[model samples]
Target: MAIWHWIEQTLRSYPELAIFLALAVGYWIGGKKFGSFSLGSVTGTLLAGVIIGQIGIDISPHIKSVFFIMFLFAVGFGVGPQFVRGVANDGLPQAVFAVIVSCLCLFSVYLAAVLSGYGPGLAAGLLAGTQTISASIGLATDAINRLDMSADQIQAQLDAIPVAYAVTYLFGTVGTGWIIAYLGPKILRINLQEECARYEKEMSEGEPDGGMQSAWYQYIVRSFKLTKPDFIAGKTVAQAEAGMTGGERLFLENLRRNGKIIEFDANTVLQVGDVVAVSGRHETLVDWSNRAEEVADQELLQIPIESIDVVVTSKNANGKTLLELSKSPCARGVYVTRIRRGSMGVDIPVQAQTKLHRGDIVSVSGSRKHVESVIEEFGFADRPTSVTDMVFVGSGIVIGGLIGAIVVPVGGIPITLSTSGGALIAGLVFGWLRSFKPKLGSVPSATLWFMNSVGLNVFIAVVGITAGPTFIQGVKEVGIELFFWGLFATSLPMLLAPLIGKYIFRFDPAINLGCCGGARTSTASVAMVAEAAKSNVPMLGYTVPYAISNTFLTLWGMVIVLLLG
Candidate 1:
């Protein structure tokens, strides 16, 4: 009774905190148990805010604004560097495709909204911003103020837009990805795996081998070796060579401390402890070992070891020298034994001062648990999707950004929205236009998920708080009509844009899904398609598109309001 009373009191005192807690709990439970319920952190939080409002709770606008700013800054920092790289590498191809797809999707949504009898400016704003209803409402309200709409009318219209947009995002993410996945293969006539492989090849170009060769070498040592039992023990090099017939070359490698071997020379002497490699037939080596075993012990003391590959994903470790990370709390006991970079399968000895890059793959050998724990601690997980398709996707971003900056005008303005956004659009356009060219690079799915979560949470918090006390009244007035219009605007693009992806550009379903998710700035839906297809490559396939879409959505809202108002 005391705990319950405390809870009730706390809820009353901090209603917004309660709402956030409730949302966190709901998403955690739902994401774990029901796969479809993985609306991600941002989407879940926003939905919670809405639920709180429906139940008559109010949160301060100031708090929401602060959180939104922080979230956006984090997102910008995380993606900014990669965005620049994408543009530099392949600017033209990415630009053309990104612009076309973004324009088509935006146009389709705007046309449907206008035809459905919505206000032109509001429809244009909403569609331009990828159905970001709050941004739309904010822009629309400002436009209304300029046109002399009453304060009451402006507040009323703004209140209901969140609910409408939320519904649109939910349907837009799942529906668009689903429709594209099913219809994309048939319409595009391209195998999903083939497309993914093309992208994977590009990303794989500069990555490290992660110690596959070392393991192979170890395997060879164990599989076809002739072992001798102290054959050179107590024998001088001259004595040991006296009975040998073949002109075989002998080498000593991987010698341990206090270990010694008789050099293959007439004047050299042998010691009891030696590790040597002899080149001869397997049968002769075994016979020699057996013969020598009678005079000594039959044991050959070589410890068996293997190698494994690990790729680094976290930015915290990316630019630091290996020596630096190795000395940190994160690199305890995990020695980087070898590195294989690019197409050469050669194993280079690990250097302490080697700087880690984001996409560098490494081979590490240690106990299984130790390796696993270190990889997890350092955020080194398998990103076959990103690795496989980074090249074309990266090229697309660069090409698209360059072209969009030069040619595509935002309301006839000659300014670039965001370099990363342009790059992303370039990726999407290239993915669509040159379906045969293959994808070039990849980004970690977890990273994308994190970005989406942060962005959405900030967006929702800002929208919810701004709506405030007038929310209920506004919803009662315009909620019904706006709901249908929002649905129409969302669904039309969901249906039509993918059709463009399939028939016109002949892109895969993943591309279509990515386009919708990107346009709306929804990460949950993008993640869902990747998860369902059991391929992270597709997730990356959609990344540039989604990025492009988000860039346009975020910038276009401001641009449309500035121009139209």
Candidate 2:
């Protein structure tokens, strides 16, 4: 009894301890599985905060704003490049589909809220929970605070937001997954795996690695002695490579003549006793007996080699296909292992004809010198680093805040974007600019993830704790009707997703499901669909839509609140 009393007193005296406790316990709860459905950390953290808040702990509202702004900025930064691409390029179909879905989501929630006679705060909570766009909660909160109401009324509305969110988030997470993964496939009436295979086959412009099955080492390097005089002995490196007949191309990186390693190029002549280091698919390199004897030339094979991810930024490489790039002199000694495109940077099916976009990241491997040259020719090398450029981030937030603070009175009603909205817009611009000028605004993926996840979770934890005192009462007031309304709002737009993708966008069956999953901004739904289809092909259509939907859904939070208010 003494220990319990001491612990309670400590938590009360130092309320910050409660926040960390809620976070730890909340993450643990979120990680647990409840029969194929698990509450994510956001929902879990919010609930934990609410439970902990029952101790009547009072935390400053400013804490919530700080964390919320950080999260909004991170989100905008992460999706900025893709958002711009979706708007300006061939991703327009998927972008349009996502916009329609987002609009429908807003309308559905508004309709549900109005029908249920809910206030703006409750409506915002429903929108956030049903869409599973946790960022919307911040927007809604900002909108509610802007309303002309008494302090007590404002607190009442603020307290009601979390109650509605906690109740509806369960269905929002699991229901969206079911509709996209299972229901959408059922509506299409096509075997997912077969359709995916067909689509993949159609997309493959050339037989990858000579139609060879993927081996442990798809790209490998081997040293061979030029023993066959009739084969490659008298030919120049370029001439010798020209004589080879196969789907896969090999590049010679080093040559050892007179027992000394020398850098060789296309025009370099080959001698009978020279040992050459060749890089290509393992399958293609396995048949070296016909041209030369395999040799373990340590000095020749042990040259400096590297694999780096290069973000495509050069106009010379943009819109070009892999096959086209491969023919360039700059690509002679480098091998592209993967092409990562779209918003999320997930690897798409890379073939000879896969086209390159300005921001696509191409993973290439070769001799260090060769790789560096390719990196220069292609775009910026995203070298592994732990440092983040804080100057750019700080400046963007300040500028965005200034921009957002501008108010334009429409018919005597003062309207402003609020600082949060400005931060989001600023993040987008900064993130996009970073793609063009890689040296500036370098927010590494790790730092961005921290800012995105911890920032949002911490803000939510504060919101939960603050609302905890009124939570039970808020739930009781909102009643069971809120849950049903959430279901209605969550289901309506998701159901329309597939139909819109197919009939309007005319997307492939696999891509249709992918776009639907992305439109809902549900990673779990896309993962489940990929599992069901037995391919990552669905992810091909995911990135652009995900980027588009994520941006708009977050903004809808403010819009819904304004309409309801």
Candidate 3:
């Protein structure tokens, strides 16, 4: 009994430890898979925090706010490039679809609240639940505070929010995942794998492995022997490569003559009986090999070849792409093996169309000479570093907080972004700016992941603990009405999302589901959808809409609360 009391005392005295425990437990639980469905970290952490909070281990709101702001900024920073690309001309339609889906979610919340005789708090909770956006809970609460009400009435309204949110959000997360993963394909009447294959065939590119994000990093190496009817013979390497067209333009990496490998240059001309090695996309290299006299042995071509990660610091490669650089004469001797954008996400395949940003650590493979050529054309090779740029990160947060402090009037209500939102906005600008000038910010990928994942979990863990006191009582008061309202809210927007996306906008089935997930701001659902599709093709539609909807839906949560609550 003494030991138990001491442990409880320790937990209460240092709530940060308790909060971290919840995160660790929740993350572990979230990773456990049951067949096709898995409870994700976000949901798992919230529940874990709730249980811990119910025990009397709780942190201050200020700590929660700090973590929340950190999370928003990292998210904004990461999505900066995608957000910019999505709003452009070619990407405009997907953005519109996402917006429409968000509006639909807003309408569904209003319709659900009005029909159910729910108050402003419940109404706002319905919106947050249906969208599966946890940020909405805070935004909705903020909006309620701005309303003109008696102290007792305000307290009552504020008290109603968490119960309704707590009930609906759980289903909101799981149900959205199920709908996109299972129900989406049934509605469209298509096999997801087949559809993705078709899309790949149309593009003439290699297939995506699950949702690796991009195919640009997918590469292959093949060796060819020079012979008669070979344009490469007696011609300079650059000139020979330039003569090839389409996917046949392979990067010449090595040349073997007289049982020895010789140095190559732009002026180094190929000779008969000389075997040369080329590296590029599998499809490109395969086709290039077919046009050769004979495919040589792999051993000679493999000599002294190495892969190195290069940092894109040169202004020339900042706005360009791996595909463009791959096609350039300088890139003919090397293959861009993979890309790590801002140290986040798995290395995406090198696709031709994916834009290059400054500071992107790109993996290129070839001989020392060819690698140097690629480095000269793009930027410098990456240096090893585990340390994060603290100065840059702190500055971004401060700037974001300042930005969030600015207020704007909407129908004379005096609206303003919370510190988190403002920081997110600032992070977006900082990230985008970093793409142009590689030296500006240096938040390591590992650090960004920590800020994004752990930060969000910590914020929600605090919320769950804080809400734990009134949680059960609130649920009982609302009865099952909140659950049904959540069901209605969750189901309606999804049903309408794909229907409108497909028939009205003519989005591909894979893309339509992605748009639906994005509009609802359900990243978990998007992941499931991409998994079901067996391709990252859906991501082409998901990213822009996800960015647009995340910002809008979070705002709408407050907007609906202000108008109807």
Candidate 4:
């Protein structure tokens, strides 16, 4: 009892300890797998904070506001590029569809809240929890505080948010996965694996095994002795290459005739017993392996090869197909292994006909010199770095706050994008700008992850602790009925998603399901659907919808509060 009392006293005296405690415990719990589902870190942190809040630790409200602003800004920045591209390019259809789907989600949750006689705060909470959008909690809290109400009334409403969120969030996370992986295919009446396999075959034509994410290199270099005298002894290197299948994809990197090293030249005549280093796609190399004598020539294999990410910014490369870019002088001897597009950096199908967008990041592998040329030709090289531009971040937030503070009176009620919303907008613009001018606003991916994940979780921890004292009372008032309302809200949009995607949009089965998952902002559901289909084809359609849905659903947090009020 003495030790327990001392611990409680220490937590009360240093309330920030409670926040870190919640984060640590929450992350540990969130990482646990429970049959393909686990309570995510945000939900886990909120629950942990609520339990610790019974200790009555007092924390400054300013802590949550600062972290929430950072979180919102990071969210905006990450999705901005993809969001803009989707709206402007061929992805416009998916972009529009995502917005419509987001509307349906907001409407469904709003209807559920109104029918159940829930107030603004509870409505916002249900929407956030049902949609599994952790960011909405911050926006909702902001909206509730903005209302013309007493502190006591505001605190009471604030308490209701976390309690409702806790009750419904589990089902929201697990249910979405089930719906996408199991129910979606049933609705479409197609075999997921077969469809993915068929799609994979179609996409993989003329392309190497760069179809999935793996550590295995899909391209290789091998040393071959010119032992096939009858077939190639007197033929020139160019003539020999032209006669082989997939010759355009192959490169004779180096050669050693007798005791002398020879540089690569297309007109060089082949000699019997001459050793050559050849590089090409793994499958193509394997097919032709038996045509020559394989040798372990250490000197020939010691070429300085490199793989690197090159951002697409050059206007000459922009809007050009992969086939066209491959023919460029800069692309000589370089192979494009993958293309990462959008905010989430999801890998899209790499095909000859696949066009390069200005912001797309292409991964190319070849001799270091060739790869350097490709980088110079496309855009800046996306080399790994640890530094972040604090100046850009601070300026963006300040500008966003100013933009959000402006108000327009609607029927005597002031309407404004709160500072949080403005920060989000600023993030979008800054992020888009960064894509074009890759040198400025350098927020490293690691820094963004820390700002995004830690910022939101910290704010969530604070919200949970603040609402802790009233949590039990709030749950009692709302009862089990709130759970049912959440179910209806979550299911309605998801249920109609595939039908709308099929009948109206006419998307492929895998893509339709992936878009639905993205529209709900559920990464787990998309992963689940991909696993079930045994292919990553689903992820090709995920990034654009995910970006659009993230922006729309977060804004709905403020919108729901306004409607319910």
Candidate 5:
């Protein structure tokens, strides 16, 4: 009894800690069983924390801060290498496009907030970050501090931003992508899949040496501690090698301005600025500068475009060989260089007349417009325009929304339903009943990773910051009413956003819900859609939405907070 009492006392002292622990435990178990129970992760964690707190357990704010920082650092490190590579490849253009799209979304939200009568700074703060409510909170906090607002006012603003941002973030990730995919061909006047094919062709032709400077050059100069190339400029190969050890491997090659590597005999004398090819470790090659100079100037072909991905379908040019396809009039100037087949994940070169099969994704490269045209001309099946397609899309949204509503309760009163849970239940019922069949497209691994990582980090940071001491204190001071209010604040936006996405944006259902997962930064919804879809494009679509939503959510949060406060 004493030990039980002590344990109980410990729980009472660190309620938040207890809740955090429960959330972690729930996530681990749920994730294992469901292959990432993301909704469970969020709601489970939150619920566990609440339960623990109710049982008198408490946790330190300092600990939460540490966890947040560590999580952010992990995220940064995880994406660093990819980020660098992205910049090196023609990622600059894509990045620019993504940013522009993101900004446009942000501007839209800002306009909404301003028109709704929110102050400029608060609107800016809410609009500044990605879907993460924590980021919006941080921005709002900073803005408040900068404006020298009183602590009370600042805290009030911070308290309300998370709820608003969360709603927008959720909508953007899943729904936005579908909207883009569905309308992009008309609005952006481009087909993404075709664009992907063209990019593949360009990457094939350019083959930019793996973005690495020759390792041979580095090894020779740095490792061998070779003498600097100073005296060998005008000497013959034999003369240049007069004092060097292991000099026989060294050779001189010449080209007449036009690039042609011609081997020079040992007696061939070198001219000033003559290009040379020298082989040996650094020290030995150092004295043979004139020879090295000739080889160093080898002209490299400039590749205009970089990496791209293509999805192969059964309808793709009747399973033609990549070489045959390239030779076709339709494939002119474009080359199918590499093929990444399915989730098996290996890249192989295109062999001539290698017969294509259904579902073999190929990468091709060429000008953007040309690539787009090629895909449009020969790539994928046209979007289904049948009434059946429309019905499927509609039913998906209704069922998904119903599931989400069932899983998580609104107003924290344990209403025995959640928006996410409702969606899942609906999916299971429809799938099991076989009455309402849903055709979910493919969800890619890259898309999954991008949306989950980017969306969640932003969400956590924004939410945590906004729910600072003052906000929490208010909840505590207000008692049960606050809990109900908090629940309402959280669920209302989630429920409404998808409805708007569906009716207004005409987004695909899976894509719509996937954005909800992204906005909340929940991996569960991502995995669910991934499991449901046949292609990864939906995942990519989710990411686009998540990114866009983050910007909007941030702005929306600030606007709501200031206006209400």
Candidate 6:
């Protein structure tokens, strides 16, 4: 006991050490799963920090704010392009369902707040806890400070918020996690593993078969030096490639004869000594090389391979798919190596059916002349430089920060988006713009993940630590009744989620539960949904609604207080 006390004292003396230890231990705890249910890093960190703080650990509040905002920005940036596309596409129904869930959450919070006769502080805290929007604490606090109340009244009300939050927050997390993971599958009467397989098979036609089966797509371009194979001696370039079959198609890039490069033509007859560079996947190229005689020129083998960034600006390519666009006559002799849409790069293994939005910047690779000609058909081609324009990102964040500071009065209730919310909006806009110009804002996936996962956990850990000491006392004041009321707020919205998602939105059970979890901003619930369904199909339904739900649910903290108080 003495040694334990001494260790606690030592950690208290250095706040940074306390925070680091909390993050490490909390993350380890979060990874622990029991039958496909895990607490997740954010929730684990919060619980750990609360326990540590209860025993007298501490960290600076400013550090928590910094971490929280970074998480918001990363989440908004990662989901921005998808959120934008979802609003107008197949995801629209999910988006509308998410709005329905959020409104219901608000209504539930108010119903519980009214029935329990909660003061302004408890009402706001209840909103935050049930919705799992931690930022609401600060925003609600800000709103309270502006209220026309005496010092003592304000102090008493302010103190109640954290107490109410602590009491309800845990169930808000765990209860929803269970409902989505265990109960959803049972209610839907579906077998997760079988359904995922069936869905995958149905969706996989014409898509690139990956792994060992993708050998045909593992293409290489080689310069063949012509020593005459009598078989193809007098055949034209097209005729030479026409005899190939089975694995993949072959295309002649160009012919090099007498120090000049000629574009391949069906009519251009190949001479005995003509050198041709041919491009095709491994299977086709290898098959052709076995019969054709070889000659290698250093310069020709090292053909100037360049990438052109072509923006999709016209209606012809706007809603058409990448596979469809690739087959256009204009796409001859060029390969789409990558498609960059802002911070997001589509994982196009064989998902060639992915629609190209108007602003998409596709990276096409081939010889310089061919790339130019191919790019001209898609849109204007620009050589996207490695340099990321930081000015655009900086300005957007700054403007967003400024915009968040303005408190608007709606029906005589003052409200503001806050800096964090503003940054999220800024990230979304900037991310969307990057999809078009692609010359600006170079945030990558790794960085976004780091900011989101690390940032949210750190903020949560700090909150738990800071809220720990007062936690027991606060719970004592509110009594267990607040918890049951919180359970009502938490359970009702989630219970209604599956019904609304499946029947109204006509989504499968996997997607409905995912939508429900996402609408609540609960990653733990989504993870549970994926685990229960034994497939990532839920995640497809989760993304857009998650983005939209996170933003609105966060703002509703203030809305609940202002409207219902």
Candidate 4 residue 346 Cα shift, in angstroms, is 3.2
* C-alpha-based local distance difference test score of model 1: 0.46
Better of 2 and 3 by lDDT: 2
Q: If both were scored by lDDT, which would come out higher, candidate 3 or candidate 4?
A: 4
Model 5: how far is 234 from its true place, Å? 40
Residue-by-residue lDDT tens digits, candidate 6, 418-537:
776687787777766665545566664456667777887787777667777766777787758999999999999888888778777888654677778878878778777676666666
TM-score, every prediction: 0.54, 0.90, 0.78, 0.86, 0.38, 0.73
Q: Between prediction 3 and prediction 6, which has the larger lDDT?
A: 3
Clashes of each: 39, 0, 8, 0, 78, 2
Whole-model lDDT values for every prediction: 0.46, 0.84, 0.72, 0.84, 0.39, 0.70
Clashing pairs in 6: 219-281, 225-295
Minimal lDDT window, size 10, model 4 = 208-217
Which residue pairs clash in candidate 3?
120-565, 216-349, 216-350, 216-351, 217-349, 217-350, 251-332, 343-445
Winning model by lDDT = 4
- The runs of at least 3 residues in candidate 3 whose Cα sits more than 4 Å from the true structure, single-residue gaps closed, are 55-58, 119-121, 141-161, 189-193, 205-304, 308-326, 336-364, 368-384
Clashes of 2: 0
With candidate 5 superimposed using the best TM-score fit, by how many Å does residue 501's alpha carbon deviate from the native? 21
Per-residue accuracy of model 2 over 1-565 as CA lDDT, tens digit each = 9998898788889988998998898889999998777898899899999999888887888888888888888888888878887888888899999999999999999999888889988998898999999999998888888888998888888888899899899899889988888888888888889999888777665544553122212457789988878877878988766637584566677889988888788888899999888876666787775568898877777768788899987878877777677767567666777878654667676666567877788888768867888888888898888988889888888898889889888887678888998999988888887777788868887888888988999989999999998999888877598999999999999898898888888998968999988888888888888888988889878888988999899999889888988
Candidate 4 residues 447-541, lDDT tens each?
A: 89898999999999999988888898888877599999999998999989988888998888768898998899888898899889877788877
The residue-by-residue lDDT of candidate 5 on 1-565, one tens digit each, is 9997887776556454444456565455334444222332432333333333444332443443333322222232222222332234423332333343344444454445555554433343334322324434433443343334677765555454433333333333343333333432344334445543443444345222421112111222111111234555556766854544553333222223224445466687655544444434355555444333323333422213322445443344544655445534344434555554322232333444344433345566654433554666554422323233324323644555554344333464223222222332343333222211113332234432333343333334324433533334544444343233333333444445455545655554534444444444334344444444433333433333343333334334334333333
Residue-wise C-alpha lDDT for candidate 1, range 154-196, written one tens digit per residue: 5544554454454455545555556556544454555655665
Look at candidate 6 and tell me the lDDT of residue 43.
Answer: 61
- Candidate 6 stretches greater than 4 Å from native: 1-37, 48-70, 150-170, 189-198, 205-249, 252-271, 275-277, 281-393, 453-462, 477-479, 508-510
Better of 1 and 3 by lDDT: 3
Task: Tell me the deviation in Å of residue 333 in model 3.
Answer: 3.6
Shift in Å, residue 243, candidate 2: 6.7
